[model samples]
Target: MGERISNSRVVISGMGVVAPNGIGLSDFEKALRNGISGIEFIPRLAALNFGCQVGGIPPITQEHIDACFSPLQLRNFNSDGIIYGMIAAHEAWRNAGLEPEAESLDPDTGVIFGTGTSGIEKLNESIKLVDAQKVRRLGSNVVIQTMASGVSAFIAGHIAAGNQVSTNSSACTTGTEALLMGYRHIKAGYAKRMLVGATCEHGPYLWGGFDAMRVTNYRHNDKPEQASRPLSETAGGLVPGAGAGAFVLESLEAALERGAPIIAEVLGGQINSGGQRGGGTLTAPNPEAVKSCIKDSLVMSGIEGAQIDLINGHLTATVKDPDEVAAWAAALGRDKSNFPYLQATKSLVGHCLSGSGAVELVATTLQLQRGFVHPSINSEDLHPQIAKWVPREKIPQQAIDVQLDRAIKASFGFGDVNACVVLRRYNS
Candidate 1:
């Protein structure tokens, strides 16, 4: 179409999820529609333990993970990053109907991953071994595996991506940021395609940091699944969750040339910052900044706000963030009556930090493909101040009668850095 030529568009050909709800995209969608929760309690952390539970993917045994890594490049992998990345990458590749080797696809395709806090548990364990006993007890590879970009680098090498490949450590916005970078690379003619997204494990140190912020919900010790009620009147705080979400992004031209089935187009994306020490706290998001980013995304995508039928929100059940987003929606003249049908994925998978946006993107892609918008469960009521802008009830599970032509996924991180991506249905 004429519109396709004016824009250098990229499409999401495949997606993968390794979250508490399930290990693959199919299982993830099923669980999301059913409103399943994967949160549970953990007794062991530091003394700051609130006994409040979290959404955690049960630990994968080393042997089980190693089987996927294989012998050739196993030594190069940092356990924390590469193990989950390989699993997700394989799932995505298979989901897209691509061979593990990338056959007809260009060797110059890139790879990018987002990671917030990497290998915190392994670092803590290494420190303990060094302090109590001896350095020999601590593994030699501990340092490499604990670094934030180790996983991204390991995946790039594993996949043999011949062009530019990198990682994003942009806190909560990392996954969206990674996707943006991939989209840009393909759009700018830098590469034909890229693998993008993020993965993280539930580590004690991350929870400890949250505890110090006095923001984590310590009151819900008995009910883990019901704890992360974003936008709910009873919602207390956003809990830390661990998981990986990834997507394969390719240029439309490249995909059709290779006979790849396109899922949805990556219409456009934008990122913005909220500036320095926001009133002494670094994590608060600014409403104006969030609005600006959304505006930019809309402009770049060449789409009207009315065309956005769904919004995958970054509805962290935090005190200030959700209200900020609500204010932005309100300022845009979107309220209960005219708001985009919204769903917060964290209510099901928990907040995966850097991995949250990508995981939610996979959910949205499935939504568009199947024409069904999943509900934001455990959030039956909204905070009085922001209730007018949020969808507080269960969304119907039936497939939408019309085509899902467009949607948006919003992600905001500490320091008010935000990223929004516009996704559109592809007409093959």
Candidate 2:
């Protein structure tokens, strides 16, 4: 951990998202405001006799694909993660008023897109071909599609970025970490702009492992929309989801000079791990580390815990939800009477794994910019333990209007990794 640079400020100028509930910014904002649930029944899961048949998948159409990919580039392109990443990245680049067809490379622009499993579907295809002694039948794009950094490489070319281009994977923390990495790159005077985000593929190949572990919700297959019940007592487990989210992060000065649309300010953030010690494990977070991560983030942002008006939490619908709430209460030194407005994006889009942090950050940014907190749907039956720390009204079931200034978004991944970022409403 290092001190935040004193001279530089980072801001999010533009954002793009491909979420289970919605495809673009306008639709996504409406979905969040309306408490729309993107979790639905996937027939393939049922056919495979999996314990959880419901999942969240973006409703992407052929037109959406055509808009992002040229016909030649789509040849044998079976990586859904790459497709979602490219769409979100392209939209973000254009949304930031950056030229995609520029003749010269952008020496000051970089990319840090990430994914947990880049192309399981393509890998599975290639495996079968090799096993059948038909290796020659494999397509030319196999390596690029299967590699972890494929998304970043694709975006680098699409935007003609000549600066640093790389991928990062930290279980579910990948997206939030990507944003912070970009922020640090600019703060250190390495780049003028960075396109950062993460994506996850939707399919049984990637979700089957969770189902086999019995960590996915199997009780709500009949009630797909209610499957992801974050903060609810009736919650069983997470409903797996997939999609991508992206942001164009620029220095405050550069954004102002270009007259770009500033969505929010990236004040500062903290990223750390529990080292799977002190009761932390491959699947659970260490309480102390979680608190320290939140506290350190506030310290870096130069704000007290009470200054945060909202908390976009990584409250996946599971037994750990109450623990996360308790950690926040301890870290902020706030009780039920004055805890900040808390909402769970997973309640609307399910647990998107590596993509969860980025997608939720987009939701958080929208709430801060628009002055409203979206409801934590399906949490009507709040858990008893969580109820002790947060008032019922504070966990809103419907969108509420409020003038928000400072908000925090935190993500805790499977490997006991945690990331917290403070964001403020942009003010001239």
Per-candidate TM-score against the hidden true structure = 0.89, 0.98
**Where does candidate 2 stray beyond 4 Å?**
1-6
lDDT of 2 by residue, 332-386 (tens): 8899889999999999999999999999999999999998999999999999999
Misplaced by over 4 Å in model 1 are 1-7, 45-48, 58-67, 71-81, 101-106, 136-140, 277-281, 328-332, 390-403
Report the poorest 10 consecutive residues by lDDT, candidate 2: 1-10
**How does candidate 2 score on lDDT?**
0.92
Q: Distance from true position, residue 400, model 2, in Å?
A: 1.2
As a whole number from 0 to 100, the lDDT of residue 145 in candidate 2 is: 94
How does model 2 score by TM-score? 0.98
Return the lDDT, model 2, position 217.
96
Candidates in order: C-alpha RMSD to true structure:
3.8, 2.4
